[model samples]
Target: MGKLYVVGIGPGGFEHMTFKAKKAIEESDVIVGYTKYIDFIEPLIKDKEVLSTGMKSEVERAEKALELAKDKVVSIISTGDAGIYGMAGLILELKKDEEVEVIPGITASSSAASILGSPLMHDNCNISLSDLMTPYDLIKKRVELATQGDFIISLYNPRSHGRPHYLKECIDIIKKYRKGDTPIGVVKNALRDGQEVTLTTLENFDDTIVDMFSIVIIGNSGSYIKDGMFITPRGYKL
Candidate 1:
């Protein structure tokens, strides 16, 4: 049996690719990923055969990687940490006989948090606003609980085309438990070219900028902005 490396490529950029991830891509005979994600690493996998597909094809993508692993070393790439909202789940779901090695990279949330300061230093929770697989009511409940619990939230897939206002709705829900002046930071293309970070408040979140590639972090009541960055106090009085 050949080796299968499930590598996380970090956010969309060559610089964000870790040394291990790059080496895996360089040594692999086959590369598999979503089309856009595959394109991000295209330069690194010049001689390999790439299998790309559209959204919602994760299961098929995983199967393809497994099949390719029958003879040659295959690298299945994902954006951000493969375990967090990446292809890791799909690969695991379909995994049966193969010994797959998972290589983690900087997740978008962590990168976003780093760029916006250390808002995740204290108790924090990562939430995906996308209700495609999860019910909205359940998501709302979690949002409410996270807000009331005073936990910093890292929101993924906050907004999309048809659900253009879903993020606004989430903000409205968060406002119910958080103060209107709660610090909310938006990080786009984190660690990549054209990276932008916007620090705003819950009340004025609508007026701020956002995109599909953005990660929105809403700090708890105890969170504050210091030295141009959002920091959540972990109860350590200095």
Candidate 2:
């Protein structure tokens, strides 16, 4: 029985991809992922059998990958770290008894934080504003608690055509506990083409641009903007 390697091709960039991820892809006989994600690693999978599906077909992809792995080395790729809002969990959940190797990669929060300086220096939490899988009310509740606890928050899938007002609603929830002057970092297409990084405050977050490809970092009470960088200090004695 062949093994399945769930790989993460971080931030949609070959440079951002880890060596182990690359090796896993190279060693695999079949590669599977969402269409856009597969395109990100086109060069590496030229000679392999590629299986790609459109968005919202994760279940199909996971099932196909497992089936293929029964006799051939198969790799299923996700844009960010496989375990963090990626295919690893779903794949593992579906095949509990199978031996699956999950290779980690740089996640969106880390990618966006790096672009904006050090906004994730302190304790942080990642929340997806998209309610496709999780309910909006539950997401809002989690956001409220994370804000009340002063956790640096990184939001994924912050906005989309169908859910235009969700991010704004989340901003309102954060404002209840955070000051208007709290630092905020918005990074679009982090470490990839057409990358845009903006540093602002909670008061002016509305002026920033965000989309499905963006990751928004909302700083905690101790976070600040210094030297044109968004930073959340680790409370070091300096």
**Top lDDT: which candidate number?**
2
> How do the predictions measure up, each by TM-score?
0.95, 0.98
Tell me how far the alpha carbon of residue 128 in candidate 2 is from the true structure, in angstroms, after superposition.
0.4
Candidate 2, residues 62-167: lDDT per residue as tens digits?
9989988888899999988999999999998899555689999999999999989999999999999989899999999999999999999999999998999999
lDDT of 1 by residue, 119-168 (tens): 89888899997888899889888988998898899999888886787788
- Evaluated at residue 77, the lDDT of candidate 1 is 89
Pairs of residues clashing in candidate 2: none
Each prediction's Cα lDDT score? Answer: 0.87, 0.92
Model 1 residue 121 distance off true place after TM-score fit, in angstroms? 0.9
